[model samples]
Target: MAEEVEARTLSRVAWRFIPFLILCYFVAYLDRVNVGFAKLTMDTDLGLSDTAFGFGAGVFFLAYFLFEVPSNIIMDKVGARRWIARIMLSWGIVSGSMAFIPEIASAIGLSAEHTFYLLRVLLGFAEAGFFPGIIFFLTLWFPASHRARIVGYFMAAIPLSSAIGSPVSAALLGLDGAWGFRGWRWLFIVEAFPSIVLGFVTFFYLTDRPADATWLDPQARAWLQRRLALEDRRREHVSPSSALASLADHRVLALSLVYFGAVACNYGISFWLPTIIKGFGLSIAMTGWVNAVPYVVGFFGMIWWGLRSDREGERTMHLAIALALAAIGVGGSAFLADPTTKMIALTIGAFGVFASLPIFWTLPTAFLAGSAVAPGIAAINSIGNLSGYFGPFVIGWIKDATGGFLWGLVTIAACAVVALAITLALGHDPHLERAPEAAE
Candidate 1:
């Protein structure tokens, strides 16, 4: 009877929430990374060298780093529904405004490069809390035992964005001269539209907590509330007392380092993969389709690895293995000159890179609960995302200096190796995940 209730309640929650959240994140990630696609031509238009483009691209995260913790704490105070909606609306406006860099630069008497940097900064500030906020919000709805798989499903939007968004973005590039706007500009306008529309819909559609989830039948609601409460009670015994203290917790700092390595690998590839593929002598559209291949592999890897970790009730080893694979694949890609072999290596790296993400998140949520969750997750996300700046900047600088991507790939691989070491050393406690009823 308990098993049946668990199944029914979780299923309803998953169905009710995951799909729509995925859609929201899909558009969010597309808007964030679509600049990679735009860089194909925007570089030429703006007279940006590779290093300048990378620095401009990475500036987004600097703003994201500055604002993420406060934004998340604010979301916790105001409720995810209101704060998240506001975040979406603001970012959507900023993201679409990316289409007008030249005109905005002219009006403000700034160069286009500075305009690019300014817009990226705004986009980062607007989107600051969205990811960690979602992670914290999930802990409110689901138990730790179920989180790896649940987070896997939620974060699948990352790879899915690249998989599907790649082709669509590439195709949009075909509109180069349509209506007197560049195709990249059209891409920004069209993609930003969904986020704005969805921002309004999120308020009406999302319930803040199980206690407030009136969409469920009474029995399911009671079961969910009780189950979640039990988990929260168990967590109270382990978590830090306040959000501020969580920022200084040893585990939090360690996890931040682990996440930094992973983010380096993720953004390093995401920002540059299109450029790498284009160098293969393919046209813009073909480059988009090819870029989708690794991400498609990564999408499945993320889901499967998350499920496997949950079933095995292991976190550290699972994360370590995935990071090891990422290090090997990304490092190997550096030495290969053939596009086919190089792509094979990158695809394997993509699987490892993405698979590690959901599993890595389980470590923090395993122990953090109540007030600690919001700031802890936010701090880790903010610090970790600093790599979003360094990774792309280093890669672009390397490409400029060496006239190739070899050393850039090697640098990301080294970052992954560092992450793997950290994960193995942390050593998670599976006991923290048990429900109060189960423990008793």
Candidate 2:
């Protein structure tokens, strides 16, 4: 009877939340990285070099890192539903405004380059806390045993955005001359509209917590609340209660380093993958399709790896192995000259790059609870995302100097190796997953 109730309650909650959240993140991620696709043509229009584009693309993370912790704190205080809706609405407006960079720059008497940097900074500011906020929000509903897979399902949006959005964004590029705007301009305006619309939908659609889930039967609601509360109690018993203090914890810092490595590889490749594929002499449309290859592989890898981690009740080895694979694949891609062989290697690297993420998140949430959850997650995310700045900037800088992407790929691969070592050293305690028997 207990097992049946648990299954039914979790299933209901998953159905209610996961699909909608995936749609939200799918659009969110697309807006964030579609700039990559834009770079193919936007560079010539804006007079941006590889270095300029990289710096502009990367500066978003600087703003993201600065505001992330505070944003998460505010979400904790206000409520995820309203705050997240606000984030989406604001970012949508800013993201759409990206279409008008030249006009805005002309109006302000600034170069288009400066205007690009400024808007990306604002977009980052508006989108801050969104990802960590969602992570913290999930813990309020799901148990530790369920988190890796749930996070996997949610984060699958990252690759899904690139996979589907790649071809779509490429296709939209064909609309270059429409309404006197360039194709990349159309890309920004059309893609950003969904976020603005979904922001409104999210407000009415989301329930802040399970206790307020009137859509659920009373029995299922009660079961979910009891289960979640019991798990919170178990976590609170050993974890730090103060958010500020938890930021100083060793585990948090170590995990941030591990994430830094993973994110470095992620953003570095994300910002440059289109350029890499375009060098193969493919048309813009073909570049979009081919660039999606790795992400398609990553999409499946993320889901399968997260499920395997949860099923086996393991964290450290899973994370370590993924990082190791990422290092090898990325490093190998740097040397392979053939487009086919290079893409095959990059696809393998993408598998490791994405597979490490959902499992990595499970580590911190396993221990951090109560007041610590928001800031702790935010700090790790903010600190780790600093690599987002360095990753692209470094890749761009190296490309300008070496006239190729060879060393850039190697640099990110080294970061992954460092992360693999740290994962082994920091490790994880599965005992934290246990809940008090009374709730069951």
Candidate 3:
């Protein structure tokens, strides 16, 4: 009866939250990266060089990195629903404003470069807390053992957004002349609308904690609350860290490097892959479909990888292996002459990079508990996301200098290798995952 009740509770929680959160993240991510699709025409239309566009695209992360930890800490104090609603609404407005950078530049007598950079920085600030806040919120509701798979389900939205959004964004590009708007402008304006709508829905729908989930029966709610509390006490008993200590912890620092390497490649690919596809001489719509193929593969890869880690009760080897795969795939892409082969190589890279993400979270939250959870997740994410700024900017510079993306792909691959080495050395403690009953 107890086992049955627990299963029912888990099922209810997953059903209640997972799909909605996926939708929320899907909207957020699509808005973030649709800029990739926009770059196809927007670059030429705005007279942007590769380096200039890269600077604008990458600048989002500079602002994001600066504000991330503080935003997350505020989320912890004010609660996830309010914080996330604020994030979605504000970013939606800023993202929509990206469509008007040229007109705004003309009116203010500012350079388009400065206008692009400014809006991106604002978008970054608005979206700062959404990702890690979701991660930390999951920690509040789910037990450690279930986190890898749960995170896998949620983070799969990353690829799904890219895959599905690719074609949709392309179609919006067809709206080029409607209302005297360019297709890329239409893309930004149309994509930005959903987030504002979803933000309002999120505020009303999200239950802040298990105790507040009145939709659940008393038995299921009580079981869930007890399970989460016990997990918290167990983790705090082992590694009890305050928020400040977590930021300074050596393990967290090391993990941040791994995350940094992973994101560098992730964002580098996201911001530039479409341009590389366009180089194949396909139309805008065809490029969107072609670019989506790898992310489709990656969607399954993340699910399989996360579940395997949970079943094995392992962390280190899984994270290390994932990084190695990404390093090899991305590094090898530079050497391939055939575009088809290059796409396949990038697909392999996508699998490893995306697969590594949810499983990576399992490591940090495994030991770090108490007040540390918020700032710790925030610190690690903030440091890692620094790559979001550097990766694209550097890649753009290299593309202009070398006349291609080969060496740039090679550079990002090296970052992946650095990550793999750290994960191999850090090692995982099975004790951190041991349930309190087992320890007792």
Candidate 4:
């Protein structure tokens, strides 16, 4: 009876929540990273240099970094429904407007580069709290035993977007002569609409907590609430008394650096991989197909790895192993002059980098709770994502100065290794989550 109840409730919750959230994030990530696909033609259309484009792409993170913690804190105070709707609506407007930078620049008397930089930054601020907000929201519902796989499922949207959205983005690029606009213009406008529609959907469709989840059966809802409540009480025993103290917690600080390193490698690859593929003499359409390969493989790897971590009830070792794999794959690619070998190495690196992400969140979410967990999650994510700013900018600078991506690739790999070491040194607290027996 207990097993049946557990299975039924969890399955219902997963179906009720995960798929819709996945679609929302799918559109969110598509808007954010689609810039990579756009750059193929956008750079030429706007007369921008690689360095300038990198700065424009990466400047989004700076705004994201500045607003993330505050925005998340606000979400915690207000509710995910309102804040997320506002974020989506605003960013969709900004993202769609990206297609109009030239006209906007002419109207405002600013250079196109300056206009591009402003729009990217605004888009970042608009989208700031959404990711960490979702992660924190997951903790509110899922038990520690279930979290990694849940997060794995949610975070899978990242690569899945690239895998599926890349081809669509490529197709949009072919719309160059249609509607008196460039392909990148159509790409941004079409992609931006889903987010706006979804913002309204989020406002109406999402319920804030289990008590409010009217769609669930009464018995299943009660069971889920009990399980989640038990987990939260367990967490409160270790969580700091106030949310403010979490801002300075040593573990939070350490995790921030660890995330910084891993994210540095992840975004470095994401923002540049299209260009890297283009360098290999593939046509633009072919680059999209090739770029999707690593991510398609990555989609399966992320789920399997997260499940392994959950089943074993081990966070640190799993994270360390993934980060180490990332280091090896990405760095090793730097030395391979042969196109096939280099692609193979990068594919391996992408699998690892993508896999590490979902498992990494399980650690902090395991121990922190009540008022503190909100700020702790925000701080870690906001600080950690600063690496996003550095990663692309440095790669672009190195590519410009050295006339190659070799050193840039090496640098990103080294960051992943550092993240691995940090994970090992600050291994997870066993009692903070489910016991091994419970996992079994």
lDDT of each: 0.92, 0.93, 0.90, 0.89
Q: Output the lDDT of residue 266, model 3.
A: 91
lDDT of 1 by residue, 28-129 (tens): 999999999999988888999999999988999999999999999999898989988998889999999999999999999999999999999999999999
Q: How many clashes (backbone N, Cα, C below 3 Å) per candidate?
A: 0, 1, 0, 0
Q: Model 4, 1-440: lDDT tens per residue?
A: 86798888788888878999999999999998888899999998888888898888889999998998899899988988888889889989999999999999999999989999999999999999999999988887777888889999999998899999888988899899897999999999999999999999899877778888888889878877877777777777778777898988888999999999889988888889899988999988898898898888778889999999888888888999889989999999999989899989988998898899989999898878888888899899999988888889889999899999999999989999889988998888867786234433
Report the error of model 2 at residue 3, Å: 0.7
Write model 2 residue lDDT over 1-440, tens digit each, in one string: 98899898889889999999999999999999999999999999999999999999999999999999999999999899999999999999999999999999999999999999999999999999999999999998898998989999999999999999999999988898997889999999999999999999989999888888999899988988888877777888667769988889888999999999999999999989999999999999999999999999999999999999989999899998899989999989999999999999999999999999999999999889789999999999999998999999999999999999999999999999999999998878898875557634
What local lDDT does model 4 show for residue 30? 91
Model 1 score (lDDT): 0.92
Order by lDDT, highest first? 2, 1, 3, 4
For residue 215, give model 2's deviation from the true position in Å: 1.3
Compute each candidate's TM-score over C-alphas. Answer: 0.98, 0.98, 0.98, 0.97
Give me the displacement of residue 271 in model 2, in angstroms.
0.9
In model 1, which regions exceed 4 Å deviation?
Answer: none
Supply candidate 3's per-residue lDDT for 306.
94
Off by over 4 Å in 2: 438-440
